[model samples]
Target: MKKTLIAVAVMAASGIAFAASNVTLYGVIEEGVVLEKAKHGDTTVDLRSGFDQGSRWGIKGTEDLGNGYSVGFILEQGFNVDSGDEATSGKAFSREAFMYVNGGFGKLGFGRTGALSFAQSNAILTGWAFGTGYGLSSWTSAIGNNFSRMDNVVSYATPVFDGFSVHAMYSNGLTGDSEKWSDNNHYYGIGVKYQANAIRSSLIFEAADNKGTATADTLVSDVLTENQWNALKQTPAWSTVKDDVVKAGTAKKKALYVINYGFEYNLGSWTPMFAYQFAHQNQGRRTHMFGLSAKADVAGGNVMIGARYLFGKDKATKVGASELSVDGDVRAWNIGAAYVYPLSKRTALKAFAGYADSGKEWKNVEAVGYNGYQVYLGMRHSF
Candidate 1:
């Protein structure tokens, strides 16, 4: 009889423990067909995944500790639904892997997660109207190098006061180096957000310290015009110049910084959003960007339209105390629209089209110039 009673007591304790904890599994799958036209008149049609949003699966759990305190964790992974491959090679949880504690003192988090700037941009900037997918908002904001996530981060969010809150984060090393404490790839960010009845606004500042030499090819290519680059490549002194450029880059580390501001106003069926960003680097590079967007509810669906413009200033690359003129000025614009119709609470059909012009200045940099248009028809399901 004693043994039977002890067993019952143990079972009761188990049940109580289980009641304090909750777990959930969730996922989003998006797939679409896309028609793309390249700058040089090349055209392609293909099936794509995650055009609207990244296809992902995740697990999350929370343990209530009573007294208005709780602990939770999330592990999310992204994948390509069309090819059945992980979004990031060799990584299982690429999107988010973090844990947090919440209470009256606000929330504290650790591990890999979205950066404060990224969160602010999504909450009050472009994401309110057009999702942060393949759109102008994303393109313009990318000039600031506002990465979505950082590794080895410690983050804190203050309790809201009158619809105002503050968030801050620091990453010891973003590259996952073995000696993280000594790694030079450090990131720091802080932001303020205000959300009230009909308006939402945010401002964020971020900085990063990167250590390492800019590649020889990048230095030479960026410092010279297309014709100059082609001519130099054919000269016998090209190798020597390239080596000198590498040495110069190696002598100085790059420091990057950016500031972002966003505002949105909601008026019943219509919402308008505006965002601005300024980015600068120690190498004398600077950029300014502006974005505008709106969303409206019509016919039991929502339609979104957005436009962005970006301009960059020219800077010179210094090699051994001599400045090499780099015509890096860029002017770019993009406009797009999307319509999403809900088939159910967790399912939606979406269609979008956009056009972008990288401008003549950006054509010199193969990585940035993309004069093209794309059209997509897709479906998204969430669970």
Candidate 2:
């Protein structure tokens, strides 16, 4: 049973790092068998558990604290090896829990990590492989979202020069409500990368905020008035009482912004990737995405392909008093592929597939019943 669940998670991370004398324990365990299909609907099949990656377990500790300093910690989590669930629910090291301090002007951490522009835009659109395009490759759901993993952060990294490096982050939100903390809300990000030798590049920028306001059924769903337009046709329970008077209104701020750019190049065995992303909001929504990936080596192992495109705008709303509007130009396209072989050096065996579509006012409104497809086959190991 997956090596008895990795020997009971390495004996519960060596009994919680037996008093921590530089602990260490790692993990990975993938499971697969998927099928999916959706768009016109009906197909289904399952058994996927972190398909190509992301079934995890982790632990690491450090201590030294001498002139060169040191002190670290990390506890990671992610699961569902078929049905253990908890890919993050009630947080038990949901992904990572941090604490660090290092020297030479680099490394500094706090809690809940990730979000230096989602790890430099997923390592420049996955040139930093794992499960193809960001694990379990399915063309990364057409590259969107991401920029999560943050919860009162405060990170920093730097100490690579010549090959370039930099990262920064911030978060506040701190909801202990000092009268709603302010700065609108809070979150921040910054990134830079270089890597050299085979070329690599990255850039990131992020932001988040959002205050409060607008209620009254969200301003009568965004513009109605005159007693919410005479209580919207007076039926449907007064349109559910103007959406419960716009969810009991009062909140406004809405801020979000992002910018990312990536690049990669190699050769020899081939490698190429590119990325571009933009997402904006202040309350006008906007999105954009573009990606391309490639990897090669063939037969013995390795092969990946990817593509993506997206465009967006959304606000729409409006279902009884009319007024709010926007959604009319969003698009999508995706493609995916994967292969892997190995079977040693920690196991492997893989396959992947993906598809996506949209265009024509985002047919089916995206990922939900949007033209879809997926395929899987898996096995992966690591310890």
> Which candidate number would show the highest TM-score if scored against the true structure?
1
* Model 2 per-residue lDDT tens digits across residues 225-309: 3334433545577445543343345555356677877777888797887777788775555778777777889978998787777
- Residue lDDT tens for model 1, 1-383: 44334434554776833342566667899999988775555587889998868899876668899999999888788899999998876566877888899999998988887776553212233333664575433542333346566678888988999999988888876655333254335788888989999988888888876543243223332445334544554688956674453234545446678888888899999899888888887655678878888889989999988887788864544322223345567677778889999999999999988877765455433221245678889999997
User: Candidate 1: worst 10 consecutive residues by lDDT?
Assistant: 119-128
In model 1, the number of clashes is: 0
TM-scores, one per candidate: 0.80, 0.30
Candidate 2 ranges with C-alpha deviation above 4 Å: 1-20, 26-35, 40-42, 51-53, 57-59, 66-69, 73-100, 103-106, 109-204, 207-285, 288-328, 331-359, 364-383
Top candidate (lDDT): 1
Q: Candidate 1: which stretches are off by over 4 Å?
A: 1-20, 119-128, 135-144, 180-182, 213-249, 314-326, 364-369
* Pairs that clash in candidate 1: none
lDDT values for all models: 0.69, 0.63
Candidate no. 1 TM-score:
0.80
